[model samples]
Target: MQTSEYLTNFSAGIAPIPQDQWQALAQHCGPFLQYSFLNGLETCGCVGGTTGWQPHFITVHRHGTLVGAMPGYLKSDSYGEYVFDHSWANAYHHHGLNYYPKWISAVPFTPVTGPRMLIHPNADKQIIVEKLLEQAGRLEQFGASSCHLLFAQDFERHNACHAGYRARWSVQFQWHNYDYTDFDGFLSALTSRKRKDIRKSRQFLQASGICIERRGDGQIRPQDMAFFLSCYQQTYLKRSGHTGYLNQEFFEHLLKTLKNRLMLVIARQGDVPVASALFLYDDKGLYGRYWGSLRDVNGLHFECCYFQGIEFAIENRIPLFNPGTQGEHKILRGFEPIYCCSLHRLFASEFDAAVGEFLDREAPVITNYYHQAHNVLPFNATFRAQLISSPENKKGHF
Candidate 1:
């Protein structure tokens, strides 16, 4: 398809694409691009401007058939995006420019990396990307200083780099499920000290009389949500000046509709709930979304958020656990440095060139950082191999 005919802006003409095509796109692109998943983000009201997320989704059609789509936004501020550009915003401010109302293509709030440019099966990805750039070229009219595509897949990341999207890399700790028949098999691969430490952590949770429960869908009571929010609030308060981006309704809606894909790990003491971690999963992996605790307990966060999720993944056979982003702490718990990707398209030539140069300088540092983080893994080479080996993880399957 010619790029022009293939592209259309839907700022005011946003129409619901048929479910079949949406699912087909996801299946063709694989699980991370699932329709139910993206649609759920919209249906839950998380992506609309009422919550500071304004969807400006872009689509491509070939011969009147849906072929590609990019879930984008006219972001007024940079809150939900895991990739940070506050420096650029600051620079723009110092130069008397406004950086708000920029364009972004990403999954809101969730930073787990997969596909960002949703391409249909057999579609010309190059054309899709060109059309995207063409639309992004017009970002200045929307008062956007630049357009950013976060956590794009490797191919799209490279393509964007070549097409003038400055590339930036960040390290996120991810637990890859090696083929382990069970949790014990996983622990057996750890070094004696790390293994013992994890075991003792679990023991402490038990000794503290903490009971962990997994709740899904309608089974999540109002009290569960309330407790989770309390823990979540406490997390922000600890950070002085931290303001939460979401409200209770968001979780309520997620629990109601995305339940099968939602997993809530709640820790309770006697009759009181203390800590909770919220995770979302599909066929490919488990995404640990939020974790909060009202009271501090030694190793409690580790046990609840990392270890328990790993056990669950092993039991259910989920392949990976992206326990949120930016956690060096996760590395000690067996998470590896997986590079999350993003792309940028600045509108003004001089600004674009400047940002492009800035990204070139930054990308290597980001790359080197991930490489350095890799050397700090908690296991010996042999144990690391066992942890990454497929059969070891599938055996314990979540």
Candidate 2:
């Protein structure tokens, strides 16, 4: 079974790697990158078959001992990844090239950023990165036109850039806890107008006879999950004319395997659930993943998704809240703009150069948008003064 002293192997699925061993190497990574989460996607049929995501997990071993791994998929279409490449695909089509089958290293349907290259703490990072890039380059043999590492960590993105991948930039809104005491304390830092607007939203929900309940771990029952899934599918159907990317089995598996890390916020009117927001968290932060409503009440979406997540983070002492992607609306609700990057390597040289030129032209615009968005943050003068006075502010950490 042993091939070489140092071997890099790509599995058709993650089933080959032992869960405990793989998890040990992935220490400190987020729940999305965990063994259970990725495996659930495969086992529940959310990823395989006609879903267009085929697991192609990469693993590195030395003397038959696992040292490095990455969650990878052979994607037939650019559907779930938040890093949009449909334009690139169109460009390929205009050039009379194929771009359908591509390789991506990311958590399917999850846009939150973390480590794409999962390396053991004691492993040589540079060597692992080299082996990974080598394997990515070999995707051409499998009829893949490109390899994308989406929503990668800063270090991994930099490494990929050094290894000659084109860097793509995007922005997401996230709320940070600056030692706030509670939800009211969080609002105190916001501008007067924003504070009033938020208060009005909450008042609308309150006056509608809607009661918000936060359920986590042991409190989240099977009925709650079923209700959440119904709402999730209904929302997706209304928006996309189809059900969601995830199925009930996928969510049920997540609930069973990642119970403690999962949190659900249910909005009820006189003992009947009307809406729900699902979140995943660790000690570091909370991530708002999915939300849907059986009934529409004014300002209900904002209260269920953003405000509830903020309250939960504050009460639990979690530092940050990433309320999913792409909304200028979140900025006014106290979520600040955060920069995220992805890396890509196209197999065709001519297409690669063209895409590189496009990215070069696009980078400055994205940077400018981020800066503009930062100026519009709703923080009051006192909070702005506090941020300016902090040492981390000097380094532009946020």
Candidate 3:
């Protein structure tokens, strides 16, 4: 396989690949290796240089056929990445070491778990690993601290390990779907207390005159996008020193290219949209991506992000809802803790070992935590028995 390095230029010959090619590749590679969803990030300038998500994508071909590809970035600052390495950066600063510019292979501003490497089904995994490793070596000359692969898939784990990268584990909460007839069927599976609690949380919006509505690209008006963007910005502004990476162009692209897979759930008060949550879906699963509320209404967050998503999944027969990363709040609401893994290849031996040790220590705690959390599901003995006894229900339990 011949490897080529494409620098982070948005308008170069190596422009955004066509959606058909991406979908074909993703189909050959599998569902999570989506092209339309990923390339949309570049075409819309969401992952461009201005956003500190400069693309340094890697492509490998054999006999003039695309064999393997990796969507990577020359990241200046780590903002949207879920793998928190701020402590490592601070440690580097204390030791007078440079750590800002690093290499990361991930979906920018997205923390959903999926494949990082796109390899043809017949491609040699070892060869792919070697080429990717060689690419990581380039970062050292550029004074990068490390090359990290965040939220990688299970198959990529072995190859990354062979490439001498350390593995780290993180947790995110997700709701699994069973063959429920309706929302009540789902609610019936929960304990009485939990069932009532979720019902009450959703009902609270009624008092605020905030009604939930589903709007797609066709149904969305211009003002609707403006309101959605406003709420999205508010989510970042509340946190000090935060800047949003995406712009109106990105949302516009999503409307154009991914309208069928997109759903914008809005919370409205007297015909005014106050809060909205954006979700991406396929036939199998629903991904709850970005969401924010204009007004801080109690229980609105759960209703808009979780309950609404669950209801949608139940109605549409989508099997799972991944509501971003790192929230214990979603646990009691029937979201189970799922493990997300990442692989890192640090340039420095000392730092590499340090991170390896850190992950070693962290993994056990995460494992035990998941076990403890698994016990906290709001389902009673009967519901639990039914859920466990049924293979389909068990599959949806995440």
Candidate lDDT (C-alpha), each: 0.75, 0.89, 0.76
Q: What are the per-residue Cα lDDT tens digits for candidate 1 across 309-336?
A: 8988898898988888886788777888
Off by over 4 Å in 1: 1-7, 12-20, 27-45, 216-223, 237-243, 384-398
lDDT of 3 by residue, 29-118 (tens): 423356665666777778775777877766666655555667788788888897999988888889899887888888887887777777
Each candidate's TM vs. the true structure?
Answer: 0.87, 0.97, 0.89
lDDT of 2 by residue, 1-398 (tens): 23345698898777788988789876589888888988898899989899999999888888777888878999989998999889989988898989979999999999999999888887787787777778778889999999999999988888888888999999999998887899999999998998999998898888889999999855899999999999999999999998898899999998898999999999998889999999999999899999999998999999999999999999999989999999999988988888898999998999899899999999999999998898888889988888878976643633
Which one wins by lDDT: 2 or 3?
2
| C-alpha RMSD between model 1 and the true structure | 3.8
Which candidate achieves the best TM-score against the true structure?
A: 2
Q: TM-score of the candidate numbered 2?
A: 0.97
| Candidate 2 residue runs with Cα over 4 Å from true position | 1-4, 392-398
Residue pairs clashing in model 3 are none
Is 1 or 3 the stronger prediction by lDDT?
3
Tell me the alpha-carbon RMSD of every candidate: 3.8, 2.0, 3.4
